[model samples]
Target: MSTHSRTARSGDRAASALAYGVVGLGLAFLAIPLAITCLMALDARTFLGPLPPPALSLHWFERLASRADILSSLRTSLVLAVLTTILSVSIGTAAAVGLARGDFPGKATLTSAFLSPLIVPPVVIGFGLLLFLSKAGITNGMARLLLGHVIVTVPYCIRTSLASLLGADKRLTEAAMILGATERQAFWSITIPLMKTGIITGAIFAFAISMDDVSISLFLSDPSATTLPVTLVSNMRAAFDLTIAAAAVILMAVTVLLIVVLDRLVGFDNVVGQGLFRS
Candidate 1:
């Protein structure tokens, strides 16, 4: 090759390397806070004080087990998330199936409306829910919290399930119907199974959204019933330490486990590919 051509190729390679370095640095910066939180969970005497932990110990881990409120909060979060996952995934999946396959008047408008929960700010949704629920005379309890979680999680279910529905063999149901199968039988034997990955993905989204929610959660949490994130927020305001760290660690662990399990249940890459289709 000519000297000039080789020189140009070298310059292009250098630019590519520089771009990769910049992207890697950005990702590292984003991950730093999570690393700090993980480190704090290990510290014996660190909480809300500083970025770096001063001492490392497991004293706080033991303390978490003994805290009655912590246990209660865990139970509340689990129950709320489980309920939220079931409700949101079921409704969202049904809507997604309709949006993707079923033809009806106002389908476009209905699809857009169902996803509106994602576009609205949490504070707005929370306050609006608080007012509406109070007016209906069910205020300041698990019901209020559950409703808020359902609102937030439904969007995720729709988003995931819609992709799955679209990626599924669109003609499979028709094929089954042509073979003398009733619509219900066709859906049960063919359609639902084909869309299982997306439905499962939406369920994961539901759990994560419900458990990690704080802004909407804060508005509805009461003294008698508080979700885990609300409990952590309240605890931090009163006092911060390794206990909070342990709690934070547990939350992260649960989230990561859920993601892993979901991915295992359905190949994660397939879902990603399916999602890309809807957009």
Candidate 2:
């Protein structure tokens, strides 16, 4: 190779290394705060000291059991997350399949409209839905919360599902059809199996969003229908205490666990950065 070519390759290597270093640094920077928060949550008296107590103790975790309301809110949040995951995954997967691969009329415009929720601010969406629901005489309860979550989650679901759908082996469906399988049967047996990874990944996001929802839940939540994030917000606002730290730790753990599980099941790396119109 020429000397000029060698220098050019060396320069490219340096640039690539620098880019990777920057990315790694950014990830670690964002992770530190949560790491500290999780550590603090295990402390006996985290809120009393300088964020986390000097020493660690499982006192707060043990104390968590005594707070019945907190327990109830956790249960409620889990139920809500599951419901949101199921609904969002099912509908968004269907929508993604339709929009990404199908040749329907005005497909571009329809996809954009469907994905508008991700672009719009969450608080605005929450309040707008709040007013609309109130006007429609729909009581602000779990159903209201579910509706709001579904709106927010649909974009994620659709985007990821579309990614999987786009990467799918198109010939599988065609081959099935050629073998005398109907379109519906082909989709169910061939397309659906291939799309499972994306759907599960999207469902995980939907579940996490619903569980950790504060903006929508804040407006839509009633006393009985409060989600975990809503409960945490109420507690943080009304009283700053150690139990809140415990709750935060629990929430963070749940988030981490969900991510880990999704990665293991569908390969999280496969589903990330599929662009704005992903599964």
Candidate 3:
């Protein structure tokens, strides 16, 4: 090879190495805190301290189970997350279908309006929901939480479903209709099947978002209906401890499990890659 070609190839190799190094550092930056929290949870020490304690034990894990408030909050979070996923996926899918297939005059404006929640701050959304719901006499904590979660999660579902539908084979639906299938039949048997991946992806996103939401849940939740994230924040304010770390470890485990399930259902690369390309 010419000296110039060799120089160019060496420069490219160096650039690739630098990019890999940066990525590795980024991953470590995110992972280290989680690892430390897990380690603290396993520490046998009576008090919270640096990781790699004198000994390791599951004492904090046992303590985590005994904490009734934490357990209740966890249950509440799970219920809200499930409800949010179902409501968001169902409503968002229908809205996405309408927005994607319809030829309405204000179609672009409506799409932007639907996705506006994504751009709005969570704290602002929570405060507005609280005020509106309160004025409407909707004081029930779980009900308020459910409404907030659905609102936030719906945007994700709509975006995902729209992306999938945009890339779907429209001719399949037409073929089904020509074969004597009614519009509803064609939708259920043809369009829905094609949109399944997007729906599932949206549901997963909704569930994860609902579970992690604290700013919105904080405004909506009451003592009896507190979510895990809200409870964790309350606990942190009251007193920071290893028991909290234990709870965090549990939450992390659950999140990891969900991600694993998501990967199995629809490879992360496929979900993100397809969305990026479609958009």
Candidate 4:
């Protein structure tokens, strides 16, 4: 081969190696803290210490059962997340259908309005909701939290559902209608089935976001009833221990399980592409 061609090949190899190294470093930066947290949870020592603990134990996990506050908050978080996912997806799917299939004045403005929650800062949304809901006399903690989470999570549902509706084959619905199928029948049998992936993807996003939300939950959480994230933050302020690490690891495991389930039911790549804006 010519020297110039050999030099170009060498440069390409060097560039590839550099890119791989950068990616490795980025992954390590993200993964290392999680590794440390997991390890800390397993450590039998009373206090945080160096990595690779001298002894390993499930002491903290066992203690979690006895921690009534933690258990209650966890249950609250789970229930809230499920409710938020259902409500967000329901509202979002209906809005998506209307936005995608209808033509009307202020349509663009309306779409922007639906997605505005995503652009607005969470703190601002939380504080604003707190004031608005309190003045409206909806002072129940769980009720307030449900409303705030729906607002935050619905935007994701809308985005994914809208993408699905826009990408779906219009011909199928039209054919159904031409074959004596009413619009409602065509929507239920044809459009909804086609939009299933998007709906599922949106539900997953909504559930995950609702579970992890702390900022908004903090503002709306009642002293008597709190979500896991808020509970964790409160405990951190009062006291910190390896039990916290265990709780975090459990939370991480739940998130990982969710992704695994999604991957099993709907191919991860397809979900990511359709739900995460790549579509």
Candidate 5:
């Protein structure tokens, strides 16, 4: 081979090596904390110590099982997340369709209104909702939490769904309608299928965000109805313990399981590729 060709080959190999090294470092940065948390939770020792824990046990998990308050918080978080996901996806999808397909005055303004939550600080949103809901005579704690979560998560759905709609082939829906399919039929059969990738991607993101939210949950949560993240924060204030780590692991596991189930049912790669990574 020529010297120039050999030098170019050497440079390509070095670049590939550097790329792989960077990716490995990025993975390590993300994984190390989670690994530490799991190890700490499993540590047989009651007190926090150096890495590897010296021993391993399920003592923290057992203690976590005995904590009624934490368990109740977990249940509350799950219910709230589900409700938030449903409401946000519905509202956001509808809003996205309208904003994308509708031609009317102040369209840009309306789109901004829907997405305002993303730019606003969570603390501000939470406090504002608290006062507004209180004055509106909506005193139910669960209702308040649900509303707060839906507001925060709806923006993500709108963004994903809108992106999908923008890239979709409108001719297919028109073709269906021309073939004697009613507007609703074309929408449900043609447009919905086209929009599915965006909708599902948005729903997953909405679910995860709702599950992990603490800032809005903090203000909206009552003693009777509080999310797990908020409860964990409160517990940390009162006492720091390994049970917290166990609870965190449980929360992480639940999120992962739900995502896996979704991937199995809907093919997450297809959904994400079509929605977020589409060229």
Candidate 6:
């Protein structure tokens, strides 16, 4: 090769190496803390510290399993997450369909209003819901939690569903209608099946958000209706121990499992990127 061409190729290789190095550093920054936390949870030590323990044991996991309060809180979180996923996906999909296909005044405004929960601070949303529920005489803790979670998770469902609908082939539904399918039939047979990936993506997002939420759950939860995250915070305040670490590891495992499932079913890149970019 000519000297100039060799120089250009060398510069490109160096640039590529630097880009790879940067990405590696970014991944390490995010992964190291999680790795440390998981390791500490396995440590035999009863206390939390920077240094690893002399040996590893399952004592913390045993303690976590024996904690009735934690188990109850976990059950509550699971129930709430499932309910939130169902409600948010159903309502948000309808709203998305209307927003994507309908020609109406204030369409933009309505879309913004539906997604406002995502942009608003969680603390503010929690406080507002607390006040509203109190004023409405809704004292049931589970009811309050369900309503709060649905409100927060709906935004994810709407955004994903809207993206899918907008990206879908408009002619598919029209062709079905021309072939003697009713509007409802076309929607069920053509539109919904095509948008399944987005809907599933939205459901997963809703489930994750509901399970991980603390601020809104804290506001809505009573002593009897505590969520896992709220219970974890309470335990942290009362005492710092390896039990919390073990619980953290368990939660992390659950999240990783969900992500793996999503990746297997629809691919993470497709769900995350396609939903946002397709819109």
Clashes of each: 0, 8, 0, 0, 0, 0
Q: Against the hidden true structure, what lDDT does model 3 obtain?
A: 0.91
Decide which is better by TM-score, 4 or 6: 4
Give the Cα-based TM-score of candidate 3 against the true structure: 0.95
- lDDT by residue (tens digit), candidate 1, 108-207: 8998899998899999999999888888999658889988999889988888878777766778899999999999999899989977877888898899
For model 4, give the 10-residue run with minimal summed lDDT.
270-279
| Local distance difference test values of all predictions, in order | 0.85, 0.85, 0.91, 0.91, 0.88, 0.91
TM-score of each: 0.91, 0.87, 0.95, 0.95, 0.88, 0.92
- lDDT for 189 in candidate 2 is 96
Return the top candidate by lDDT.
3
Candidate 3: where is the Cα deviation over 4 Å?
1-3, 274-279
Model 2 TM-score, all chains together: 0.87
Candidate closer to the true structure by lDDT (higher is better), 3 or 6: 3
- Candidate 1 accuracy as lDDT: 0.85
Give the per-residue lDDT digits (tens) of candidate 6, residues 1-279. Answer: 999999999999999999999999999999999999889998976677667678899999999999999999999999999999999999999998999899999999999999999989999999999999999999999999999999999999998888888888889999999999999999999999877887988999999999999999989999879999999999899987888889889989889988998898879787767544475
Q: Candidate 5: lDDT over CA atoms?
A: 0.88
Give lDDT: candidate 5, residue 203. 87
Which model is ahead, 2 or 6, in terms of lDDT? Answer: 6
Which 10-residue window of candidate 2 scores lowest in summed lDDT? 270-279
Alpha-carbon runs more than 4 Å astray in model 5: 1-20, 271-279
Clashing pairs in 6: none
Runs in model 1 lying further than 4 Å from the true structure = 1-7, 45-55, 274-279
Candidate 3 lowest-lDDT run of ten: 270-279
lDDT of 2 by residue, 126-202 (tens): 99999999999999598998899999998999888887888876898999999999999998999888888778888
Residue 80 Cα positional deviation in candidate 6, in Å, after optimal superposition: 0.3
lDDT of 3 by residue, 1-279 (tens): 999999999999999999999999999999999988888999998887665799999999998899999999999999999999999999999998998889979999999999999999999999999999999999889999999999999999998888889888789999999999999999999999888878988999999999999999989998779999999899999988788999888888888988998899978886878553374
